[model samples]
Target: MNMDIKEIDGACHCGTVRLRVRLSDGLNSARRCTCSYCRMKGAVAVSADLGGVDVLSGADALAIYQFNTMSAKHYFCSKCGIYTHHKRRSNPNQYGVNAAILAGVSPFDFAAVPVMDGINHPSDHAGGPRVVGTLRFVASPGE
Candidate 1:
């Protein structure tokens, strides 16, 4: 899929954690996982190339949570406790931006995106599902 690379704005539910990301063309390709946490939170993730994402505001308001192998760092807004994004254990260079946190984005079909087996996450990343979907952002009316 062809995508335009540009800057997109995102934030948490309470708007406490604002972010600016240099969205890559591949961002349109997303991944849905059946992992315990992912299932519970209903997160649709898209990877940003290394150093592509930038936290524009509320950096101090962000809180990180880690569990299990503790390789992934889940970042959320401390005040609202809304999960906004995370640094994946499987890939440190890429950041997983939560689709829900992005403003002006509509719900998408999971089937269109690739599915990952985050349940039994691979250690060496030799065998794992790949992400293959695109992300579209529409500017909210009146900015």
Candidate 2:
């Protein structure tokens, strides 16, 4: 859970798919998108260069899914049906690895995550992306 970590290992819920990822900006790149696919998939993703991720195991068990523009390629664990990572559509040179899959990480780790205006993608318009809203996490008094 150290923010200084630049590289980390990850796995799907079933551990069928494993990955060794070199983060582009440690955990600071973690974010959420308001796009149709991303909104529903609901994983807080962190940025990684195209070559930053290495499938350490169960590569064959990884299934890829693409939609609409077919630019981003979302990878999931075929066996456990857990989302692992995806080739980013906005920036093809990067991948958005599911933060929850990373060791000692959780969706609630961040106090607030900026929600990008994916409904109006930058590629679809001249202006760049905007923050539509913020997703916040407030922990209870006790466990």
Candidate 3:
């Protein structure tokens, strides 16, 4: 996480459900998942700690979907069907927020987003893959 990461506002497609989330790494952890569900409903995710999200309005409009292990809770707007965020199955302590939902963040803001191995999830493995390579970001065409 960056030393100066800040909180930002986000909302569903219909402007019903609003949220204030303190981004963990200021979009540094943005990624795309290739799991069965994500493959169907495409959304880029950025990281936020479990305590970082605050539902500011229209909590009643929020809908949750849980499947498989039921550890990950995916949330969206009941009316708009806009994905908001989800409790990551791999790391229950962290959240994967919809990057496109943030005020100024866009999926295109990332030139290359690492696809996590969710199809073969880490939580299912006895001991996780030991080595993690460095993550390098390339600015989008115009930067």
For lDDT, the strongest prediction is 2
Candidate 2: residue pairs that collide? none
TM-score of 1: 0.78
lDDT of each: 0.72, 0.93, 0.82
Clashes of each: 5, 0, 0
Q: How close is each model in CA RMSD to the real structure?
A: 5.6, 0.9, 3.5
User: Of the candidates shown, which would achieve the greatest TM-score relative to the real structure?
Assistant: 2
54 in model 1: Cα distance from truth in Å?
A: 1.4
Task: Give model 1 RMSD, 1 decimal.
Answer: 5.6
Clashing pairs in 1: 28-133, 28-134, 28-135, 29-133, 29-134
- Tens digits of lDDT, candidate 2, 46-140: 99999999999999999999999998899999999999999987888999999999999998989898899888987789877788899999999
Rank order (by lDDT, best first): 2, 3, 1
TM-scores, all models, native as reference? 0.78, 0.97, 0.85
Q: Which regions of candidate 2 are displaced past 4 Å?
A: none
> What would you estimate as the lDDT of candidate 2?
0.93
Off by over 4 Å in 1: 1-5, 109-111, 130-143
Pairs with steric clashes in candidate 3:
none
